[model samples]
Target: MMRSLGKQTVRTHYQHIVAGVHDPEHDHTHETRQTVYERPDGTFQINYMSGKRFVMATNDGSFECVHVVQTVRSASGSTIMSVIAGAQSLAVNRLNAVIEFESGDRWIEIEDDETARLAAGLTQTAVGHFYHEEERLEGRHLRRWFVLVGPSEDLAVVGKVALFVLPPHETSVDPEVVDCHIAGYRNGNPYPEFAAEIEALAAATDLPITPNYMGDPVVTPPATGRTPGL
Candidate 1:
């Protein structure tokens, strides 16, 4: 069975670790202490990035999925959302969704069990703002998608990645957060690449291709197809 979050109030814990290796992304291996939080909710979200970078790991409970994020930040100051919807490249099975929403509600809806599993099974876990907290309305206006993953899952493969989609004119920069790491980002979708995995998931789901909700339109998903899950 999968673990999930309940209605109880919770607090995050902090930890520090040191290792000897080279990080291609940052060109460094040493890491600063970071905070980690596990929402008992079925999403299996694992906040494991170092305090220097804003990243996340997630579990896709409802669909047998997993995801990660190398959260990007915006150079400009604005309320934005980086939504995921398609695959990155044809060589891998990861989905890529790095879309920016500056002024409207967004959603990453799963239409069926197959799609849910596909969405959950990808690599990482993250959220977007097509359904973020905006204006005076509550968070309900912004629809978000959650997936299931476990603590023991290995991310050595091309697990799905959640990239932040930055504005066309802005440069993506690493965040300078201190103390507690952040789960939210404004740059853009962390993964903007595409893959066959997305095409398979779309075939097994029921959300409309060109969808609209809360006076805003969602990004078009990959073309649909039949896969093992369906």
Candidate 2:
């Protein structure tokens, strides 16, 4: 289970070590002492390095994910600090995955592999907005197709599962547009089975189905494959 803000209020202190330091007159080692206070209602505070402080709070529990990144630069004592908050951890994971994927070869070959293709499709559905305008539009269109078929709880599950199986920093289609180009045959009638396959794949991989923000139960598919009139 993902980390949740529960009734486990605690305070802790630790040393964060920074490696690979070379100083002419010093011992060539450095570490920072940090203190953290976590509350049961998902609020937390951190203090480090001469009164520098970071804090986060949740009111109605809309936000659940938080990430802190520290970057060190070679140029004359340069450092960067970043804090990110999200509604769910999956979004943050997918963002990290996209970043890693983009930092390397953006293009890859799907080679008619069904699983890879499916993964690509789900990526398009989920984070395609991170891509260029054309590719983002494509993703929007595909999402529209799913919406037209009527909203199902499985849609989000399939999307998250696909993201889990996707290769790090790689896409089988054109990296420029981040296009998956799923076949037309799989779009309309076969979508239910397609969704089922994705769920099965996720189960095979032991990927947990992320609960909705409200923690609702999963529902069955609607009787009609396509939404009425479209």
RMSD of each: 18.8, 19.6
Candidate 1 C-alpha lDDT tens digits along 39-129: 4452333232212222244252221111222433345532122212223112123332322122111123332334343433343222222
Q: What are the lDDT figures for the candidates, one per model?
A: 0.26, 0.28
Model 2, CA-based lDDT: 0.28
lDDT of 1: 0.26
TM-score of each: 0.24, 0.21
* Residue 45 shift from truth in candidate 1, angstroms: 25
**Tens-digit lDDT track of model 2 for 69-128:** 223444555332111111222332333121112112111212223324333344323222
Backbone clash tally (model 2): 1
What is the Å distance of residue 100 in model 2 from its true position?
24
